[model samples]
Target: MVKVILFDLDGTLLPMDTDAFINTYLSKLAPSVAEIVDPDRFVKALLTGTEAMIRSKDREKTNEQVFEEAFLPLIELKKEAIWPALDHFYDNVFPTFSYLSKPSPLSRKIVEEAGNQGYRLAVATNPLFPRTAIHHRLQWADVADIPFDLVTVYEESTYTKPHAEYYMEICSRLDVRPEDCIMVGNDIQEDMVASEIGMKTFLVEGYVIDRGEPHYRIDDRGTLEALFRKLQRKEGIFAEK
Candidate 1:
């Protein structure tokens, strides 16, 4: 039986052109930090920090720590000197980028239905952003008020998506086997990697990031929503699987 349902935020739940969203996000973020550091250098540092977070394998340190360690040195600034600006940017400027994303009513319905069926819900978004930034995006998806069993954020997660360890970490936290979890996302490369550790996966198609060939067969969100309805009726894919 599936005990957990993990959903990806960006392209999956929050309808968005990922590249366009990032471009707008960084463009806004650059100006916010321009007073402390040059805009170009700050953007480079931010990307470097994100890369560090993505490559993080150290279970001892959080992704936030890894990002800070790599990011601060590049700009020759201390965390004490830069954190307030980042905090302000996320609190003030980040929400303005909500215009770049469209809320999916289906996403909310899926989450609500899953909750009603007693399935644990998790926002398994990539942990490159702080919790505040993630929370704001969740609000845009209309799932901010829906209680999530777990939400991956830089302060709590060490590994990023596309890494099997990332999925394993979530399973460990929830005290469930990977086989008992289902990951739903738009990126074939990142979300489908959950299958590497034995989690079932569903790929949402509209904003798909298709790579070579997926390791597991992919199912669309429509099929998944139908499956949810069937599960509610105690029939269909859930019963068969």
Candidate 2:
């Protein structure tokens, strides 16, 4: 039984160029934190922190902790100062990032259709952003109204996807086996890697990126919708007895 359907936010549901999304994100993040420290240096330290987290042995640490360790000494400021920047990001700067990600009409239709079919939903987006940021992005995609059983946020997630443990945690929390889940996303490396854990994988081809490696093919979104329609009629995607 395909009990859970997990979808990535960026590039899958919300359409955007990956680079443009980050540039708009940083442009807005910089001005907001200018009052607290050197903006350029601050962003640099933040990047360093991000890299550190990628290599971190202690996956239990939140991105905030990873960030603060690299950023704190440079600013010589209290932890309280970082809050303003984050607050600004969640309330103001983050909204502006929405301009970079446009809503797709098919996004809502598929999500709504899937929900009606009784599949548990999850936004299995990479948990690099806080919950607020992730939530707002969902709203931007107009799929915010669609209830998700679990929205993985960096603060709460111990592991990022592409790591088998990440999918394991989601299955454990949702009480579903990896075999009962389908991870849908645009990135071949990040999203399709879920297959390694035995979850079904769907690559949304709307925004394809060829990274000079073996391509994990995704049946197009239209094909997916049709497949769901067939499922609704009890004609499952795979042959059934």
CA lDDT, every prediction? 0.85, 0.74
Error at 208, model 2, angstroms: 2.0
Error of 1 at 136 (Å): 0.4
How far in Å is the alpha carbon of 223 misplaced in model 1? 6.9
Listed per candidate, the RMSD to the true structure in angstroms reads 2.0, 2.7
lDDT string, candidate 1, 1-241, tens digits: 8889899999888879999999998988899888899999999998998998888899999999999899999999988898999999899989888999978687788788879888899999999899999999999999999999999999999899778899999999999999898888888889988888778777776787777765555533444355456556755324535
Tens-place lDDT per residue, model 2, 140-239, is 8898878889999877876775667778889999999998888878888777778887877766666754575554534334334554555456453322
TM-score for every candidate vs. truth?
A: 0.93, 0.87
Instruction: Tell me the deviation in Å of residue 119 in model 1.
Output: 0.5
- Number of the top-ranking candidate, with TM-score as the measure: 1
In the predicted model 2, the residue pairs found to clash are: none
